[model samples]
Structures are given as C-alpha cells and as structure tokens.
Target: MTLAKSSELGITHLPDHTELPESDGTFVKNFQEHPQSLLLTDSITDVLQQLHPDHQFAIGQDCGIYWRLTEPPEKGAEAPDWFYVPNVPPMLNGKFRRSYVLWQEYVAPLIVLEFVSGDGSEERDKTPLTGKFWVYEQAIRVPFYGIYEFSKASVEVYHLVDGKYQLLPANERGHYSIPPMGVELGIWQGQYKNMTAPWLRWWDTQGNLLLSSDEKSQQLTSQLEEVSSQLEQEQEKAERLAEKLRQMGIDPDQL
Candidate 1:
C-alpha cells in the first residue's frame, strides 16, 4: 500500500514492510506453483548460505516486491514465483518481512524466477510500468530473470546488459551460469516429493546437480549401507582365509 499519508495535512512517510498488504487477493494459478517454489528454494539454500556467510540474504516465494507507490499498494508490486536478494537480512528488526520494499531497501534482487502456468504471456509481457517483464527489467532491474515452463520442460533466462534484457545462451551442459552464486540454472527430470516431472532446478557451474536436504540425507544413508555391506563381505572373506590356514596345519593367529 501507499506510504503512511496525511490528506488533511500535507505529509507522507514511506511505509515499511509492516504497513503493506502481503497479498493481492488472487489465487495461485495452479497447484504446481507451491511445490515448484519450494523445490527451487530447498535446493539452493546451501549455495546461498555459503555465498552469504553472515546469513544476510533473503529468498522470497510468491512474495511481493514493491517498486513504486500506488493507490492500492499491491498494484505497485510484482510477486515472482521465486527471487533471491543478496546481502539483506532474512528478517527486518527481528520480525519477518511481509513484503520487500525497494524504496526502503535499495538493493535489488539478484534474480527473479517466474513459473509459467498458462501460455507464458504474463511472464514475458514487456508493457511499460505494468508488464511483468518491463517491471522486472526496467523498474526492479533484476539482473537475471527466468521464465520456466514445466510442461515444456524448458526455461528461458534473460540477463540484463547495458540497460536491456539479453537472452542468455546455455553453456555446453545446457545450463545458465549464475556466476555470483557459482551455480547454474537448468531443468531436471526427476522425482521430488514423490512427483516425477521436469523441475526447474539448480546446478553447480561444473554441471553438478544441486541436491536438496532430503536428497543429501538419502545419499548419506545409501553410502553408509554400502560401506556396511563391504565390511561384512571383508569379514566373511577373512574368516574363510582363517579356516583355510588352520586346515593347512598353520596357526591362523600366528600370522
């Protein structure tokens, strides 16, 4: 919403996160949106932590980023499916931020991602002031903007260069490099939370898929199981050797 205003008296003060409306009274376009947002956030958290050792970073999921003042505050904001702003505290004054106010915090989001629910028109709209593309590139000036279409199993990434959006070409491994975080953005076909589909995911610059916390745990468990099985096999082999030595009339323990 607009700043704390005074109509009777000529006075106005930019409202902080607390004074803004958190939502725009709109329904999430589809069911996949929530899980998709979480998948992106869950997978890249470690990278973000390492990038911001002070833990001064914020990731917003379907959260509003207010760029300008408007009659109905939500109109002035664009709520991306996912976004990451670097070097900002996860909270403001020990309280969760209801919305990201750009005027209050001059730092722009490093990247903003939009998941396509329809024909992808909205995500690519470049109409000045109101269009999502224009708002992100011109107003918010998010350095990296991605439009992902799960049904198509593809994403189009744009990098802002020289005050214009430039389509970024994928590297040899078909991923877009985000140098700031030492990671790449790409689509992966896999199972997440029991759903098998093409998901928008992150990878290291070297083309290693970034695993979520659950995936990491599962990997550790598998490794432990393998190690235990090897130990058992080695123990059995040693016992067999001892028996053979005894049969040969040699004290197995003496060796």
Candidate 2:
C-alpha cells in the first residue's frame, strides 16, 4: 500500500510532544511481568529500530494508554498490546517509558496490535475480550488494527474506512497490508524463539519481509562459522601438501 491511497493524513497536524505521569512505576512493572507479550513486543521493537533507527517515532510496548473517553481514571480503557506514533520520538529525549499520556499525545496510534490471549481459561485462552477493538477503531479512530492468534498462528488486519473498521483480506502470501503503518502484518510459518508458529512478522510496504534482530544475528553467525570451517579446511590441506613435499625430499619453504 502507498500514501497515494490516503486522504490528508492527520499525523502532521498533531503536536509531536508527549507527557508522562508523576512517578507511577507500577505500570512498567506490570507490563514486564507478562511474558507472553514478549514475542510480539520484541518483534515490534526490532521493526521500529530498522524503520526509524534514530528513535524518530513514539512507540508503546504493552504500556499504559490514555483513551479518548471522559471516564473516571480507573474506568478508562487501557493501552494496546503494542502501538506506535510514527511522527514522534522513539523515546522521550533518549529515554524509555512506562506509560503513555493521551493529553500529551494528541494523535492516535498509526497501528495497534492485540495478541489474542485474554483469559487464563484454556490452552487457547478463549476468554471473551474484543470490546477493546471497537473502542480503538471506532471510538479512538486508530487507523489500523492487527489481531494475531499466537496459538493458532493467524492474523486478521483491519483498516478504518469511512469511520468503519473494514477487515482486509490476506494477500497471495497470507499477509494483510496496513496502509497506515507502511508495512504489512503477516504470519510467517517459521521458527522463532524455538517455537514454530505463524509468527507475527513485519514486511515492508512493498511486501518484502523485514528481518528480526534475532533472525539477522542467526544469519550472520551462520555465515561467520561457515567461513571459519572453510579456513580450517584450507589450513589442513596446506599442511598435508607441505608434509608430502618434505617426504619427496624437498623443503617446500626453501624451494
């Protein structure tokens, strides 16, 4: 997807600054406790680094959110599993965050992700929880919503069309394109963190797969080990040739 398909994107209109609450360290602590969200969170963090290395965006990692509602502070809806504001700094002046303040971030997240793991009921975690999606797409007007079934290895992406969230079908490669994020959310049938599932993956706007940090590290390590083994073989061959020449009554080095 390209920007040509978009109307006036309101990204530039919003103020680029964000505000933090006064020393509420509880939210960050709670967010880090959820280990299941790590896969999605780490993948997203890697993508952010590649797309905007200089922290040229505002991102949330399963942290606090400020919903667009006038509800009581305790009753207001929460932040998403993961979200990003492309036009804001990745960090607040080279620092990490624990919560997001809506009053400061006037703009909506360009894309939001929900890893489908709500209830501690069963292996599938089939607890009823989708009200958040409506709140985000309909109430908050987030441009895109990405839902991933971590257990089933599936993804369904939706886009806001005429103020309605319309589900976008998978492409030829089972990837759903998100026009707002400049990337496609897809399930890659591969191994990640030693588990094999349809992993939530990031692809460029052109549909090319973006390599996660772990993946890139694995690739580079494999290449270096290959080179090392080849060097060892060469050294072995050279030693054998030198020994043969000595046996044939000539010091190869002197010759």
For candidate 1, the 10 contiguous residues with the lowest summed lDDT are 1-10
lDDT of each structure?
0.90, 0.62
Could you tell me which 10 consecutive residues in candidate 2 have the lowest summed lDDT?
Answer: 1-10
lDDT of 2 by residue, 1-255 (tens): 001111233233322223323232343334222443565555566666677778677767566565532212323345566777876766665667556555555567888777666441321222222256656755567788777776677777778889877889888777887664566778777766666666677787787777666877888999999999999999999999999999999898997
Candidate 2 to truth, TM: 0.68
User: Which model scores highest in TM-score?
Assistant: 1
Question: For each candidate, how many residue pairs have backbone atoms clashing (under 3 Å)?
Answer: 1, 3
Clashing pairs for model 1 are: 1-73
Q: Model 1, range 45-125, lDDT digits (tens) per residue?
A: 988889888999999998899987776778889999899999998998999999999988889999999999889999999
